[model samples]
Each structure stands twice: as C-alpha cells, then as structure tokens.
Target: MTGDIFSENHEVEYYETNLLGNMTLSMLTDVIIMISQDQATALGVGTQYVIEHGVTWVVAQTDMDITRLPRVHEKVQVQTRGSSYTKYFAYREFWVRDMDGNELVHVGSLWVMMDIQSRKMVKLDEAMVIPYHCDRVRRIQRLNKIPKIHDEHDIMQTEYHVRFTDIDWNSHVNNAKYIGWMVDVLPYDFLASHVPTEVSIKYEDEVTYGDPVLSRGKFINTDNQIQTVHDISVNGSTKSIAEVKWKKLDKKGSK
Candidate 1:
C-alpha cells in the first residue's frame, strides 16, 4: 500500500496531440494516470492486485496546473508518488517534465477504494496501505470544488455514446475520458486558440458501457482567462462535474 516515487520516460505520441500538435488535456492526464498505475503494479498494489481482495480504487477528484502542454514526438519524464492518506481517501501526485527537467504540469488526485461486489466505498485498511509509505493523515484535502452548472446557465451540449474502448478494468467510463467529453463541447476556434492552465474534475458516479452521456458546459470569459464549467449527465442524473481555466494563445500560437 506504500512506496517511494516512481517515474518513466515517454514520447508524446502523435495520436495524443491536438490540432496544434500539443498534447491534449485528456491524454496528458491519461499518461500520468498510467504512470501511477504502473507504479502501483510494481509495488504489488495495482488494480489486479487489489481486485483480488474484493476492492478496487476509484478516482474521486483531480486537480492539475499546467505550465504548458508538451508537443508531439517530444520526450518527457513523468513521475508519480503516493503522498498521504486518511481513513477513507488517498492522495497521489503526478508531474510531467521535459528532458531538461523543466516541469510542465503538476496534478493532485484523490482516490478511494470501493468494494467491487457491493459497489460501495470502503475504509482504508491501516495494514493494506503500509507499502505506499504515505503518512497517516487525520484530514482529507479540500481539492478545488468544481462549480455546479445550473439550469439557468446557457450551455453548449454534445452527446456521446459510451463505447467499449472507453471502459476500463472497472467496466465504466474512465475518469480521463471525461476531459475528452468536456473538451469536445467547446468551439473549434476556442479549442484551437486557447490552452488550459488549470483543470478540476470531481466524479460522483460510475457510467457504464452502452450509456449515452450528455456533456454540457458554459464558458465564462473573466479577466485574462476563460473559465468553463461542465456537467456530465446520464439519463437525467449528473455523474461528473468539471471546470477548466484556459489562457488564450496569441497570433503566433503561443500562450
């Protein structure tokens, strides 16, 4: 359940990039998440390892700050570490840095273990978490709360049918895919001319394969940054909420 920092080198794949050849927010988050899973697997605390015990980890929230998105074909080092935990939650950190060690993005995430059979969250067993080496914390971190998208807000909406590829080991839409849904609802010009500086997502429920999701968002231009609020709805219920703050790219495509 506990371990030291882990890292790996990766090339920004062509498929991972946006039109500007920079990695998309969804793929950037996905790569770091994969790094953490690799670390967990190496430490004998991975998804397969934990599932055997009738429980699995689920991401409850993610908060990230981006200095810049890496370009396609660029090699970067990604690192992850288990920071600490409380009775019911664990905090993990991930960061991407260029070959020269310049930090590009920093992320913090909250995870909780759920009983696979019961489909309910469970308490962290003191003994099970020892391998992660995370300190025992009395309190949970207050990650940035994603603002709710209310009925009054005029929203842009996009519908996506959950595909088989979107389901992970948990048999549900992976947390990283929510970013894709959120980003897809934005205007092509906006997405092309701006880069996200911050992203916050909070997952409230699981969405399974074959479900149709209505992703809706409202973009607010305030000061120098454009702030966007989003909600993912399945049926008529909200499953996830997210917020992203973007910095406009100038004429030369530099943020």
Candidate 2:
C-alpha cells in the first residue's frame, strides 16, 4: 500500500531464512522495519532527518499474519506505507507478496517518537507532524498483544552473552533478534514439526551491546497444544525485560 507520501521496496535474501529454507518470523520483523525506513527516505523525512532534530521512532508493537512461507531463492516483494499518525505515534502497514501478487505476509505496527537525549518516548514535534500531512491516521485496533505473566519465577531460563551485531538504530539490541534466539534454543524437532502461526512480543527494557542477558522460556497447555512463552532479563541486573509468545502445534516431545 503506497500513497504519494511514502514508497519503498525490498528483496528477500537466502541467509534470512532458517535451516528449513523458509523465511523466519524474526527476519520478517527486520524486513518490516527496513520498509518503514525506506518509506521515510522517499519523503525526505528519513531516520537521519528525524534524528537531526533529536527524535527517533521506536516500534511499540507489531501484529503479523502469515499465509504461506516464502522459501529460499524466492525473491518476495515487500512494500510499506505510512497509514496514519497520532499525537506522538505513527501507524504503518506492510505487505510481502510473490511476483504474481499473491500475498504471503501482512504486518501492522505502531511506533513512538522519542527524544534522543533522554531516551524516553515523547510527543511528536510540529516538524515531525508537518511532513506526513495527515490530520488523522486511522487507529489500529488489533495491535499485537503481549503475553501475560502469571508466575514470574517459574519459567524456562537461559543466559546469553550479547554480541556486537545485536544493536540497531534505537541503540539497544534489535527487538526481533531475540526471537531468533528463542527459535534457536527450542528443540529442533519441535521447530520442524510446528510452523509458527502467530507471534507477539513486548519490549519492556533495552539490552545494550556487551550486556549479559538471561532468557527464560515457559508454556501453558490448552487443548493438547502448548503456547510457548519467553521472558528475557539482563543477568544479575533487573535492568531490561522482554517476552515472546510462540503458537506451536504438535506434541512437545514428539517428532
């Protein structure tokens, strides 16, 4: 979906896929962001332009619907549009389609403008608002929902040593990469057996480069399947918190 105000396109890559040769949820999240940045660039209000004025956009939530997974060597078309703007937030939608126009994935996201110095979310400045030129952007009602925490301590836990590549423009670890780790540690057969139908994550805190983080995975049983839930925290420090939910099919220990 492109209006004159925004336009961008992306090509899929082989390394972006998993061992199964299909695009992964984590990679889709990155592609969604790149399209958003490209949209801003077309309008001359890109990240450099926004950052020059001491403000940056941070993704608050993303809801993704997957129809079919694009495989390796298949170059998909990724397009993005600035759907709307609110007081201090902007809503954007993205689509990934095959060359024949068959839709493969749909994504909608909410982003907040923030002050660069304070690192806190802030209202949209007048300059930031004037470019998009929309008085009101449609409100996205079904935002990606974060999983609820029932018992904070009883989750599957592991620790990760942060690497150099984890940081993105926002300066903390890129939110999507954590999801990659979640997929990596799960039983290989489980990943092979169940395709992820839905994923929702909450970014409660930021994990900086070089910070050690502890990741915990948990699950709830319902009607013979398990909803994989994960919470990540910086080791020895309560500084950062994050969570992810994986909708899994098939038995836990079965192939």
Candidate 3:
C-alpha cells in the first residue's frame, strides 16, 4: 500500500445532497478528504501514525475543479495518489468520477506536517516521505497564493457558533465545514440560479470549539462567471479564506 495508488467507491447519501438534490460542494469535499485519509492510513502515514510521530498532517491549500456534481444515490469512485514532496510540504491529487467513468471533479492539495504541541510546521523526514512513493508530478499545480478578500460596502457578513459536530478527530473545525459556512451566507437567489465550477481554499489558522466564527463574502459578476470570495474570522482575526466561481444555468439546464 505504501507505493500504490488507492481508490474507493461511495454512494452519495441523501444527507449529502443539497436542496437541488445534487451533492453539495462542502459534502463533496468531505468525501474527498475522507478517501484521502483512508489512503494515507493504508500507507501507514495517517492520523494515528503522524500523531505517534508527534505531528499531524494539515492541509495548507486546496483547489478543485468540478465539471459535474454527483446526484444523491449515485455511486461515485474516488481515486487518489501521492504526487510529490519537499522538505516541508507534500502534494497529492484526487479525482472523482461517475459510474460511466466520466470525471466529475479533480482536486490538488498541499499538506504540511505540524507538531501537535508546538503547532509548528516540521520538515519531512525520510520515514515520512518514503512511504508515499511520490511521483514528483502534479495533476493540478499547487496554488501560488490565494488573494485576500478585502472588506467592502456590499460584502455580506454573518456570525456562526462553532458546533461540536463541526470538529473533527483533530479537535478543530474541519476544513470542509468552512465552505458550508461560506455558502450559507450567499444570497438564495444566486444559489438557485448558478452552480459552482471551481473552488479554491486556503487555510491560514484553525478554528476550535467555543470559538465564534464570522463569515464574510463578496460576490462578483463577470461577463461569463459569477465569483465569490469568502473569509472566516474569529475574534476579529481571519482564519481561512475561500473563493468559488460559478456558471449560470438556464431554465432548460444549459450552462
């Protein structure tokens, strides 16, 4: 398992669907992270393994391009492979495809090993790098930088209480939950008329239990696409930011 790619199939549960009956972006992200973890576990470098080594894997940045959204009850296949690594960062690629083998989504992510107690990034040792059998290639290149969303007059803002379920095994809010929070603040009419074609997120800090998070977003309409930039903050400090680009769908379902 150390040097091999891994894949898994999943049924899009009803709970994972949105009002449109298609898998929500956040839930789809959850599935991608879950499968990545499963593959890491099989390769012997997952949560427990990293924790035992006094560090944990944390996502630094992620970019996903979705061509089609899986519908509820649809069985989808997810495949992942470790692609490359440096002293402090590792890259991985993931794909989600429908039963007909048409790719629905492609994702590229950057991860860092962080010391649990100090919460500082640690350099990857041979032990950590060897097992991944990185191919030294990337399906989608790592994002150089995600632009910060500045405060503006028309930006929408909302406050949310961190719930227990939002926390993951690491005792912090899972990254995908941030996407959900961002979407929750979008105008209902916009959501009803458009569908996201791409999403990129950069995790700057962790949000923990008892932390009150504020979500702010700015929507932009271009000639061909609608874009939104979101920032999640705590105690007036920014924690994470995400950007989503959407394409309008007509009443007849044409993009």
Residues 9-30 of candidate 2 have per-residue lDDT tens digits of: 4565788877667788788888
Ranking by lDDT: 1, 3, 2
Among all windows of ten consecutive residues in candidate 1, which has the lowest summed lDDT?
A: 246-255
| CA-lDDT, candidates in order | 0.87, 0.68, 0.83
Please report the TM-score between candidate 2 and the true structure. 0.83
Cα lDDT of candidate 1 equals 0.87
C-alpha positional error of residue 149 in candidate 2 after TM-score superposition, expressed in Å: 3.7
Q: Stretches of candidate 1 above 4 Å error?
A: 1-3
> Which candidate number maximizes TM-score?
1
Count clashes in each candidate, considering only residues at least 3 apart in sequence or on different chains. Answer: 7, 1, 0
lDDT of 3 by residue, 1-255 (tens): 123578999999999987767799889888889988898788787778878989888888888888978888999999888777767778877889988889999888888888899999888665866787874432335474666775586989899999999998789998889898888899887787678888888899999999999999998656767888899999989898988888777753333
